[model samples]
Target: MIVIQAKLIFLNQQDKQIVLDLMRRWSSCMKFAYKRLLEGYDRKTLKRDLQGTFDLNSRYVDDAIMKARGVLESSRQLDNNPKKVIFGGRDLFGKLQKRHINGKEYQKLKTKWQERRKGNLYSRGDKSKKGNLNTRIEVKENGTFLRINVGERKYVYARIEAGYKKNKRREELLQEIAESNIPYSVELKLKNGNIYAYFAIEEEYPEIKITKEKGVIGIDINAHPGNISWTEVDEKGNLISYGNIPMPELASGSKDKKEYFRWQYAHEIVKIAKEKGKAIVIEKLDIKEKGKRGDFSGRKSRRIRHSFSYKSLLSKIKTLAKREGIEVIEVNPSYTSIIGMLKYAPQYMITKDVAAAYVIARRGLGLQEKIPDNYIKFLNALTVDELEELREHVKKTVRNKHIKKKHLREINKAMEFLQSLESKPGRVLEPLDGTSFSAYDFWRVLKVAVVTPLSPEKVKRDFSVLKELLIQGKWGGP
Candidate 1:
C-alpha cells in the first residue's frame, strides 16, 4: 500500500517550562526512593551502586522501577564506581522547540535509559554531576515534549511540550533510514529560496507483468550534481539500451544520477508501451516511511530528504506510459547497484543539452587538461580498448577535471608499463597499477587482487600474458 508520513517543525517558549517541571518532579521522586533503598540496604541485598540505581529510577520512567533499578546496579558495578546524582540537572528541553518528536518518543526514552550512564535521572555528564541527560524521554500527550541540550557533552532527556510549528515539524527529522524505490514518480522540487513547498501526492495504478526473459542493466554510479542510471528492456524484457546517465552528486548521496536515470528510463517505458503492450517493471517504494529511520540524525535529514521529488518524475512517466498502454510491475530494486542490474538495464543520463561525455570520448574527444571527467572519460591519447570501455561507463563516472594533466599522465604510465614485457620462468609479476584501474571497458580487468584490498580473487583464467605485457613495473598503484 502507498503511504505518506510528514513531519512538521516549529519552535516556541511555553513548552520549555513543562520540561523543567517534569524534571523537578522526577528528581524529588528519585531522592525519596534513595532514602528508602538506603534503609533497606544490605551489601549483599543491595543491588549495587546505590546512588546510580536511584538516579536511574527517575530517568527510566517507563522502565520497570525494579528492572530499571536492577540495570542501574549492574551498570554501576560495570564501572566499579559511583556516578554523581543531580537534582533536575541543567536545562535540556529549552522553551525553543516544543513539538520535535513522534508517536514513538516514549518507547525511545525507555530504551535509551537502559544504556550506560554517567550522571543522574536526566542523562548527564560526570559521575556525580548532572548530565544534560540526553537519553530519550516520553512526554504526556497533553502537548508534553522531550528534547536534549545539543552540546552539554552528556547523556540526558528533558520532557517539554510540543508547540505549533515545532509539533508539526516533529516527523520531519530522521537519519539513515530504510530504502524507498518506486517505478516512475514526480521528482521533488527544490527551492533555492524559501523552506516552503506545495504539492499534492499524485497516485495511480497500472497493470503489471512478469517477463520470462530477465535482463541486466549495468549502472555507472557517479558523484555529481545528480544521478542517472542506464536502463532498457528488450522485446521480451531483456534490457537492451547499453547506456544511461552517470550518478548524480548529492550533498550526502546520489540524487542527480537517479533523476536522469529515471527520466531516461521513463522515455524507454513510453517507447515500449507504444510498441508491444507490456507493463513496466520496477520496485515499489514508500518515500515517507522508509525515510523515518527510527528517528536517528534528528528531523532535519528527513525534512530535506522529502524535498527531492524523485516520485514526481515517476508519476509523469506512469501517466504517459499508461496512455501508451504499457503495464508497470515492481520488482525489489534493493541493492540493484551492487547486484549489477541483475534483471534490469539501469540507465545513466548524460547532458540533456548534449550526448554523454563517454560518447564523445569514444570518438577521441580532445580537451584541455584541467577539465574534469564530466567532460572527458578516456584520456585523449588512450588506447583503443580503454577508449571503448570509457564510452560505456568509467569515463562518465570519473571526474577527471584535470583532463590534460591526468589524461597524459595515465597514457605515459600505460605506455612505459606496457613496454616492460618481462616474465620470469619460475614466477609471474602482476601489473600493480592497471589491476585496479577503470576497466569498465575490460571486464575483470582488475586481477581481482587490486580490486579487493582485503579478500583477493585468484585468476581463474591465464594471467601471466596480461600481467607481463602491460600494467606492471610502476605504471601506478591500485
Candidate 2:
C-alpha cells in the first residue's frame, strides 16, 4: 500500500473554513469513540452508542471508531501499562482519513455528504445558532479524489489536486491512480494553512520470487552519517565490491531535508542492487533497546539513533525493490560487526563497518561461518578460562613492572593479538593486550613447570601465519 498526497486548491477562505470545521467535528467523534473504548464497550456496542452522540453519517462515525481502535492497539503494542495507552486526541483526528470501504458504499457516502449539506440543520448561519443540533460534515473518497461536502454544487466540491509538477510527475501519479484496483483510504491534512489530501492506493502486484544470482549486497546500518556500509558478494560469499556510503546527515538538517536524504540513500542502495542483479542484505536492527542503554541514553544519542531511520530506509528499499523484482534479505545481527572487524576487515582491507556488511551479505548467501585458523587451534589448546587467565597475568605483570611506555605498547599489542584469536567461534577472549614475555617467559612468570616451553616469538609468529591463512581463505571465496 502507498499514499499519494496532493495540495487542495481553494479559491476562497469559505471553502477552507468548511474543511477546518469538518476536521474539528471529526476529532470530536473520534474522542467519543475513544471514550466508549475506555469504558470497555465492544465494537458493536460502541458503534451503537456513538451513532446517537455523533449525528454525522454512519460511515464517518464508523471510520472514527476504526481510527480510535488503531490508537488503542498501537498503545497496547508499545507498552503493557494501562496508564500509557493514550486515547484519541485532537492531533490524530486533525486530518480526516479512513480505510477499507467498498466502491459502491463510497459513492453512496459521497452523494449523501453533498445532499445532506442542503438540509436546514447544516444551513450556514443556522448551524451557528443551533450548535450541537446542527448536522456535522462527513469525509468521502472516490479513488484518488477526496470529496468534501460543502453544501452546494459549485462552492467546494472540487477534487483534491496532487500538486506534483516537476518533470510532469503529477501526470504519472494520476495514471497510477487510474490503474490501481483498490484505493484503500483517503486523508485530509491541513499543512501550512492549506488542505492536502492523501490517497492510499493499492494495486495487485505479482509475488516476488527471489532466485540466487551472482551475489548479494550487505548493508551495515550505523548511528553516524557517512558510516553506512554496503558490500557486494558473489554467490559463494566472495567480496565483489565493498565501500562505505554516507547516509544523509540527519543530525544537522531540517526535517524535510532529512526526509529527502533518507529516501535518497534508500533509493541509491536499491538502484545499486538492481544494477548488479544482487539481493540486498541488511541487519535486522532494533534501535529502541540501543537507545535505552547507558551509552546511548543521552539526548544527543537519542537524536542520533532517531536520525538513522533504519525502519524508514528499509521500507523505502523494500517498496522500490518490489517494483523492480529484486529480493531484500534481513539477517541476524549478532556478532556480525565483531567478525567483520576482527577478521574480514583486515583481509578485505576495508573498514570494519563495511566488513560487517560483508558478513551480513555472506550470511544471506548461506555461506559457512568463516573461522580464523588460530581460533581453531586455540579452541583445542586452551579453554576460554585459561586464555582469560593468561590475559590477566600479562596485564598485572606489566602494571607491576612499570614497563616503559614503548615496551608496554608491545605488551598491549600482544594482548590485542590474543583477543583476535579468541573472538572466533568456540572461544571467548576478554579483550586485552599481551605482554612482551614469550611463552617460555610466560610460563616462568606464572611459576609453572612444563615438559615443553613455547617461545613468545614462536607463538606470535604462528598467530601471524594463522591470520594470513584466514585472509587467504577470504580471497579464495567459498
TM-score to native of every candidate shown: 0.27, 0.46
- Model 1 lDDT per residue over 292-361, tens place: 3555332333433444454444454555555444554444333332113110111222221112222211
Candidate 2 per-residue C-alpha lDDT over 342-363 given as tens digits, one digit per residue, 9 for 90 to 100? 5666565676678778889988
Q: Whose lDDT is greatest here?
A: 2
Lowest-sum lDDT 10-residue window in model 1: 172-181
For model 1 the TM-score comes to 0.27
Off by over 4 Å in 1: 1-17, 33-60, 71-220, 228-402, 417-478
What TM-score would candidate 2 get against the native?
0.46
In order, the Cα lDDT scores of the candidates are: 0.32, 0.54
- Pairs of residues clashing in candidate 2: 226-246, 414-434, 415-433, 415-434, 438-456, 439-456
Minimal lDDT window, size 10, model 2: 443-452
- Residue 206 CA error for candidate 1 (Å)? 34
Clashes of each: 98, 6
